[model samples]
Target: MPVLVKDYTWSETDTEVLITVPLKGVKPSKADIFSSEDYVKINYTPYLFEVFLYAPVVEEESSIRVGNGVVEMRLCKKEKVIWGQLESNIKMDKEEMRRKREDVVKAVQEKMEQEQMERATKKREAEKLAIKQQMQLEEEAHSKIEKEKQDERDKAMEELEEWKQHKQEETKTTSITNKPTIQPAQLKQQQNSKLSHNMWQDNKDIPDSQRPAPRSGGKITVNFTPRYFPTAARESTEKEEQEWLAKMAAARKIQAGTPSEINKNNPMLLKDKACGFFKAGDYEAAINAFSQAISLNPMLPVLYSNRAACYLKLNDNEKCIQDATRALELLYPVVPSNHIQRAKVFVRRGTAYANIGNHGLALQDYEAAEKLDPDNTQLQTDIVQIRNLISCDS
Candidate 1:
């Protein structure tokens, strides 16, 4: 229904008998009023005035109506109006039609532009989500590949370890079959040089002056010879067996007390544990464990000697000498029965004494160890060096 009509201007330089239609709560659409040809038709005719209208202002409580020489009009969802009769044939008012068309056109163009912006925003969001999913998938694949590689490495290491154990067993069996049971001292002396000093092998053939100086002092000199034991005679066999058993015991002690496994079952376990710690290159741990072990079992000379070794490794000569002196006090009297053990403690203590510049005490320990174990290569070597030092000092 027609509501009100008012005069309006489409442009500053253009005028017409104008009409505006108010939609109230309803917005007017271009599809309801105009066609595709209307825009082309409007652009070609400048005689018709242009018009601008807004989207329906539904929230406004009141409406407006005004009339000048130009006519302003209002229309609702339910209304249509007729303009005053055209001046020519029964025809449309070009100005009135243009005004109506332009209003609808502007609204449609704005709506299309808004829809395009929303579409572009949705597309960008989708692209970002796709990139995030792809990255997550790649990370999962990489993690799986890494797990597989690590599994392969672990399997290879296990197989290699098993093969090594098999070879070691075969070597042990072959060596046992080829060699008869030998005297422990004879076997030990031969093996000790290889285990205790690899450097000696390289320089063993070299003359005295050509060899490096002994770390304790004086010159380095060594002598080696193979000795035969009587395996046929019963007394000789018993002596050989006893000597062999002692050598085996010593070997077991050395192996068991290595840094990898300290014999906790033994009273000397704590000391051995400390020695192990020192071999593992953790001097502080070795020292503390050794001290604790000594506290736990003070009567054992081995514990004191072992702790002394740790102190020596740490370059704490005073503590080393103290431990060695303690070991000597406990061990010296029993040398007739336990010469090898006493000799080892003496040599170690003497080394500590030498480090502190007490040549006399160092010499004394060296001499004592030598007297107890006259055939011990290590003790003999040490005695020769002490004698050389005495000669040099004199």
Candidate 2:
């Protein structure tokens, strides 16, 4: 059951009443508030606050401000007279409260639906605009390609005309008798070049200058960006955003000092830091902290024992067993002062063994812990459980 909030403060003027509800550890964005002419409510998960107004107020004019671990509300009173109380003294039973809750919930859900519709409409408009721009860009690219082809054809025609004129002039100036004796390899190269020129020139139906050009040989590889979206690279923040996220992940990683600097700080402090991390449910960070503590002082049995608990939480059964055994070894010659810790070490090791399907070894370790702490009911329970497991296996 949620505890009722009765300790809230209120002040009233002739035409306004201000109420402040202290809600510790509550964020403003997460708190849900509903206000009507005669009702005011604030729901912050486990905590719920509601009040029936002593006098009717203008709900639309009223305002609520949440900040600094408190929710402040100002109600605009309809009447000019000062009210005796901020809320009605009459207490509401469960049925009345339930109806009020349902009413406010319906209103909130309706408001949320309207907001979702607005967002969807905006998204559709944006998508349509993007599609139109992309289509326009594709059309422009098609026209540009056609223009480039025309320009290349004109350039080829000019080059072919210049070549024909040069060949005619060379023929008129030279004679076969004046030609030098050519090597067989050179004569064959000239014959191949003449055959290639004639092949394009042999198209008599089309004008010589207008003949189709043969493309140069060799592969031309073109690479395009691998993207799921059609957005241009210059318009996207994907690369920068990814780099920022990578940096944030790196910053959150656990970092331990080098072995040479492990002894610089107090072992107790390092152990405390490890315990804090373990309590916060960061098992990986706790393990790193525990290792640093162990490197500073390996003789401390408690350090190894605590690190074992972290390993157990992470489900590293073999490492848990190793740490627990190391702790037990360091806690030699069981005495009155260390009996509790010794039993704890035995329990941890036994639990690790039980996890790894070694019921026989688990039973042995539990029995040892029972001898150290005879009154430990939990330890006795574990002993019984191991015995039952061993019996079932046999």
Q: Candidate 1's residue-wise lDDT over 1-394, tens digit each?
A: 2322123222211212223433333312110122121121111111222233222212122223432322233222111333332122312466866666566455544454455456656876998998798778777767776776677666655654565577568667777567555577656555653554354555454322222222222232332222234344543545545664554355335422344543343345455455545544456877787676655556666777877877776668888888888877765335134677778788877887877778788989888888888887877887678778878888
Q: lDDT per model, in order?
A: 0.53, 0.72
TM-score, predicted candidate 2 vs. hidden true structure = 0.39
Taking all chains together, each candidate's TM-score versus the true structure is: 0.32, 0.39
Whole-structure CA lDDT of model 2: 0.72
Q: Pick the candidate with the highest TM-score.
A: 2
How well is each residue in 80-188 modelled by candidate 2, as lDDT tens digits? 9988877664445667767765675456445544554566568769989988987787777676767766776776667777766776687689895885566787666
